[model samples]
Target chain A: MIRICIFMMILLATYSCNDVLDVPSQSDEDIVLELWNHIDRNYCFFELKGINWDSIKTASLARLNVSTSESDLFEICGDMVLALEDGHAFLRNGQTNIVYDFKEGYDVHFDPIIVEKKYLNSSFQREGIYTYGMINDSIGYVYLYGFQNRELFENIKGYFKQRNPQKLIIDVRNNGGGDSALSLEIVEYLIDEETKVGYISVKNGEERDDFTEVANVVATLSSNNYPVKTNILINRGSYSASSYLAGMVKYIDNINVIGQITGGGGGGGQSFELPNGWVVRIPHHYFLDAKMNHIELGVEPDVEIENTELDIMNQRDLMLEMAIEY
Target chain B: MIKFDLDTYRLRFSLTPIKHGVTGLMLMISASVFSQSNKTMFFKAGFVQQSTFENRLTSNYRGGVGLNLELGFEKTSEKYVSRFSLDYSKANQGKSYISYSTIYKVDLKYENLKRIHTIKGLYIGGYIDVGTMINEKNGLWGSTNNPISFTQWASLGMVAQYSVKFKNDYLWNMSLSTPIVSYIIRPSYGSVWPDKFLEPQNFNLYERGIVTAGLKSGNVALFNNFSNTIIKTSMYFPFKNSQWHYGLEYSFNRIHTNEIKPLKQFANTISISFKRL
Candidate 1:
């Protein structure tokens, strides 16, 4: 027994993990090929968007050589990521992020200078990324630039107690988006029961059409309720979780979404490491709005209020003005 | 908040001696602590090492090593023996020891063996073990609500054991176990925000649901697979009325999955246990 015990102890004491695996190659071909292959199998959209990923991959490889510079390769990879037309598509390169933008033709209407000087002046109180104040005395206004707000609902509650406004305006014009859960927390407060918001699913297999079973997206009852009618203002820059918020709350009666068509980024994305160490973020989960309409590109406003260049030049945000007027 | 920086995301201790000395000190302390103590609680400290290839995250395999701690017990009788264990481990994985990514895991297990026959000092029996392994990686962030990469599994496996006795006073036990069938839960492909986060109340065909897996998973074009095997042996030394138990355990897990990544992991640990009369 003593001999067996000693042997096992000796074995355990001597055991050590060796660094055995060969280092991965960082050649240009290897980098591009890895990105192409990984995206080919893992990227969720192709069939949905009718994109020829193979053709893009072929073209991208042709542009590269064994001696392609890091900057040129980055641009090439960036171009490939943009081919999906997904605004959520982002290639993280160090501190400078290579992100996709679909808001080129669509103009940004929210004039921060005008809103600050004209509407908020010195009355706005800030919480997280949301900036808020009363615009028409009886009407409350909240400008949400991002959903990184943890105290969003709390900020609004304070505003309610202080102003006692009958209606609230939620301006999400250039709000790029953040945690969707934060958006849901506020939306759930406006509804009564557990509501079916939409259907959500994602790509499941290597095939472009391969998808997981669809799940009915439901919003449960909120523990606390917000007082007053709500109006959400959006524009071409409203995307991802912002669009998701609009799509979700469109089912509520008391809440109104008023603005131009939003920048549609209606799926969830995940990140992967490129052979060159750049991080690529892509979305696979796509959502179907309450009426089963695809909101992947953007969400249509319940009431379209186009904020023209003329409006901005005249120091007026028509979208915000419309919400305040309503 | 989780930050996925391209360069590195590692939490290193400020004190070098503490960080470097922890492994050896923990091994010695845990060995002595457990030995002085069957139907008994025990503690174990060891190294957990892994080589992982999750095509969803990267094309190349990543290697890592870190500390592992386990708390478990063994109860034995002439006709039967029962064992239970729970363990936690954390590791940072990347090439050349670069702490680019982190993985956290928790494991739970239970086993019961009934002796069918005994020849010489060798007793043979089949044991039943039901357990689960939950592993989460938080090294890189890809997208908001990427509900897809979550991986956890509840499995049932078959066990085989060998018992040895010397001079009718000392006891030695060895066992091998494999997870043959499992009801695995993972986020459906491409979904952001794992089901565990989004639909905690619902576990259906879609969202957070059970996907059946057998000996092997996945197919030709691109795939990651899992095969879980565990080997354990323990020796008991009696002192007066109380008993001391020394043990060695090694697990070879070929993390077969269709979730996000496929990992090859090996855990080596030694433990001492104390039991009452």
Candidate 2:
């Protein structure tokens, strides 16, 4: 009995000795290292962009010191992540917000005023996230400003049913992306058969290349198959889900993309908090076009056309005009 | 008969060897007939205070004050003892995140009792325990409302217990169980939310119901990537001719895995029990 009791005591003592809760207290340097390591492991565009993440870490660390305030540290961290050149990567502190400087730097190729007055014959109707009308009594025009409102797709389908125009123009030039699902919902109305839209791969492990097997993202054609000649207008300001839409439309037969290259952000964002309570949003999945091309560098237009200052001065949207002519 | 002194004869008759043998025989017979093998049924209710930490849900360990209720039955024979119990607990944790969890558990145990030397009221035993636990947790944000976040474990383990009977049939028992094999079910990482099953396009009336939703989340697993340990101690004081007992109990359990996060739970309770034999 004494021997058995002693053995049981030893077994209990040794059972979970290694299971210690060791959440380390973070110093400023430790926070930087953690942030760097987080990006090194989880960020999806590192390989595609050919960025040396280690050099970014070293450069950021050189700028840090004991006298650096919390906000300064936040900025340094944000700058380190912005080096990835992905618009989906972002960080925010109390007074500072960091995002890829895409909008202010790119030239404005789309003017809503010109599009409203000249293209739609000064008759623009707004329904949810969609602005639609008939251009010259021949082309159906729908300008999607965002992808959040799903009901707009159904409404556009109804409008197309009523008009039955020979050509359709979809102006998504400055449509900063929202939901990818809603983008597919819009594509379903135009496609006539099951289409392999693209592929999506996610991080399955902590390693950089520890990605899951790529899965084909298919968009099934909806019952409303309005097979008019479709022209999608894209520009350097078209981003995220809008860029994804550009990639999808390239596979459909009746669609032709016009204008400048899209501003690409082809991954989904996931948010994580730092030790000091600031949030960092990183892209964790890679979206590939049907040709297995990484769309992180933006999709090119089928017939590249740039809007000039003269075109804007004359109240002409050249891209919309091209779509109308096509 | 022979001319003997009356006092001496009386002493001899009182001290006879045969008379003492007959008395010893009768006591042995009565003891053999009325053995201490019986069955007992008990119901218990108590206030419980619990603390839990689940890293998948939150980073901090949260404490809650709640109620614990239990019903149990035990059968004891000369060689072994069998026990079955049903227990339920509900608690709310945290103030900001505000997590709430309810757990229902059922356990059946069989122990082979062994007598100990040098301790008159003590017994040492090895037990086989089979139990199932279902726990649901939800909070203010994230995937709390999703059914996939709920946890269910079907466990089989070996237990070691030391039980002591004190004066007037009072009892003290301490047990420790480490699950050698467990089947665990949890949500997959970055998958569709469980509410997708409740949507109109994919809805089934039976599966979308509240009760069935909780049950369907349980997936079978066998000794792969999951482990747990449970320790419980209790004291019972008999009253009213040993027909009723009052108990105080404390239990601690920790479960962890590489796939999901680790969870630790502690419960302290005081209960009233009734025993039927």
Candidate 3:
């Protein structure tokens, strides 16, 4: 009885919704369906994805081998995730940042240069997030510590546009996450308007790829027709729209994502109070890159640099140096 | 104790950051910034007698001291009680068979009840501690010639305790104490073999300074002799003004060595401490 109570308490502590209390009643399929309904209603862009989710879910679930392990369920769930074909769409557990980069047959591999980064700061310290600094005089650096306001976007774009530096290094090494629209708004100056950044697809167990879309970078700069030379510095820690911004920029080719690759795809986190009142964030949506490639493998880095104790001792900004030299 | 004694002597002094408007300050003259009100601080000094059930034959009795600090916060209202505290303790036992341990604990506790002896006095609280231990002088006999080794290790644990206060004043205070349950993991002795030996590292600026001064003063002998034990000895030093709080307290402790199934035995000790709380 004590163990059961402990288990229930833990389950309650971990689950974020009233429906989560009914998790025991629902099979894996029912849970997936429930998540799909929740995301379809709440995702920032559900209807725009434009895919038939039910058929996609049917196709994806049909591929499952009916295994009774957590991994098998994850694999089945992962296979279901691919139906969206939008690189930004994915499902992930918190265990490992490295997921099967679905583009490569969803093969298990190390988190891409991008996806391993989620560790810059476990709790992204909410200090001065929009603080701007200059590195090597050539790179205009604006560290988006937290993505809170449009003013941060305005600060970066305005700084870059006014200075018109030859190369701009937007340091997103520490950005945990924020608004995707805010990120997409910043991408406007870097990419041409007609350029299709990538697609975002959502899937349920039976409703596979219910939503799909080809989102265009709506940043005011390029939408207003100003393409600036940009290089966004990403560490393993960047996530959410920040990771999306990196992948979207990677597809455009004009923007070189420097530094180590990111800890690829992150699930769209939903905040909910567990039955025990412990606030939790559960990731519900998985994202991919423009080529229907899942970045859960993380976006690859143009240059790979490791942070070592020796580097800190010597006071080296290896990423900035690599970007400047490149 | 694996302390980080910095090279400089630094003192931290904090002043209230909250500002009161002129009208607010004038309206409440008694609640001035420098209210001589009681911001309660409790320092517990006690000792324990520890025995090893597994290694009784080889180990001897141990007597060591423990100190804990409790810092109170401004009450939000008369109905609610909240406080944040940093708890630390150090204990040492035996002459050649010393065990030293230290813990840095931070916890936010809330009192569910205000009145004493009532059912509402049933309080629940929890605290988390990250600490380190060092042990010297192992084996059944107090022989320095044994193939003993000193260990430096860290541990993490949580504590839940319940108590009802009889007298809540700084002096003449009394309370019945009982721990709900506290879980601690002491890493297996001799786990790190030849390649990975334990060495002490500075944990903070103050400890770094102490270490540097000790080293400069040629006090390597102090550490070299008592290097093998797992408990922290610095916390057990019988000094009344050892920490920030002024209090009087007492405790009992028991510690023992880890050995083979038969040879090792237990070490026990008891201590009584009186200080400003």
Candidate 4:
């Protein structure tokens, strides 16, 4: 019996020692299929956007042949991914870049030159990643164009604590989101109590609805005391974490969001690389408001005001003016 | 009392030599006379090297070097033996990721001391082990920002061991174990960032407890989704007939799984141990 056991152990050991280096051979079609399957399994917005992924795959496969160039394959893959209509989705190779088309026919509503000359009288104070000053020496105006830096919020908070302005305006027009944590940190300075902001869930399986249980996301008050009343300026360009911030601010007190509806991007982006060294990014997590409503469509402002071409031509930010009036 | 109890004294003296000779014969028949029933404690520390590949994160398998430490205790009797050990290891895979793991294992076995006709001091045993492994991997590439994959598994396996002792008090041991079942905790297809997952209300005991999500309902699998194989060998030499013994040990462990990602890991370690009987 002992000899039999020893012999079996040796046999098992010999079988296990076989190295399992099973790297899949990637042909052009194989790479396309890999990309499709990755997105099919991981992308968060498939069902929400009513995408027919199988049809898309079939169409894409029909475009690929033995003689298709890599550039052409990249384009076909890019076009197939763009069908998801998510701004966070993109495909990039060495020389080509494909991104969701966010530009619409709306005229540019924000011009810094005009705002600086007409609104702040050329006295806009520039801090780290933030430009701040008083509009009419009353309303504190802080313009944050991006959410990349966490320290910028601290500087803005310190500047506001000293001034003790009764009203403040946070302009996030054209602010493309960077890091959601930084956006949440900025939200911390705007509230004084535990605020149930929203819920977040991630794709748990390959099925479209295979999501984990919704996890409640909350914002706690910061150490610094900010202004009692706040106005957030947003436009169609506010996206991703910027849209997430807009959703959170609606739950806070004494804060009025005023502007055009934000350009919605409520999904968190995750990146995967294709076999040919190109990279593809897709949204893999969903962010919803406290009411369980998906925020993929841009969040509506408390007071929806559209800036006209006339307003820009006159060097007047109508939204900022509305925030000051509020 | 002056009338000596001659029968009792004569019987005691006569039985003493007979008892001594019987004990000598028994000792001669025993294969390993030095392996008396005793409890022992051991401490081991060593260098570890690991190679890992996860298809969800990257295509290339990466290698890392790190350290491992273990503490163990074993009890031996004529009928059975039992041992318990705790091991911790940490390794870094280039700039992409780092992994840390801890395992606590208990093994119970029945010893078979019957020797082959020509070979001496040979002992064979079959053991069943129950253990838990907690592993965490943190790095970039999986998500937008920093990503972390945390997994915990309750494991059970069977092992077969062969041990031999030489007349010079040197002992050699070899064992192989394969997992029978494991309850594994793997993140869903898309994992939330750690900062969000650690939120007060978002974090719950269920996420860290046995009732958490897994590959199947009730989260138990019999070598279907997750499998592990381990092999170890050691040699021990006593120091001048003292209770203390020093030994060198080498181990190889591999785990393969098909979950959110197809992940395969191989770890090799060599260590020196000190055991006290």
Cα lDDT, all candidates: 0.63, 0.63, 0.38, 0.66
Total backbone collisions for each predicted model: 23, 0, 94, 0
TM-score of each: 0.76, 0.64, 0.34, 0.70
Per-model i-RMS: 9.7, 25.6, 26.6, 21.2
Candidate 4, TM-score of its B chain: 0.66
User: TM-score of model 3 relative to the true fold?
Assistant: 0.34
Model 4: pairs clashing at backbone N, Cα or C within 3 Å: none
- Give the alpha carbon lDDT tens digit for every residue of B142-241 in model 4: 2333243444466665566567777757888877776557665554467533223423365321223223212232256566566667888999988886
RMSD of 4: 16.4
Q: Which candidate number maximizes lDDT?
A: 4
Evaluated at residue A11, the lDDT of candidate 4 is: 62
- TM, chain A, every candidate: 0.88, 0.90, 0.57, 0.92
Worst 10 residues of 3 chain B by lDDT: B5-14
If both were scored by DockQ, which would come out higher, candidate 1 or candidate 3?
1
For model 4, residues A90-180, the per-residue Cα lDDT tens digits are: 8877456688855464555787656667777455688655788777656788888877655666777777777777888888889887666
**Which digits, one per residue and each the tens of the lDDT, describe model 1 over residues B174-239?**
766655455455444454233333232341222222333211232221111324556677776667
Worst 10 residues of 3 chain A by lDDT: A16-25
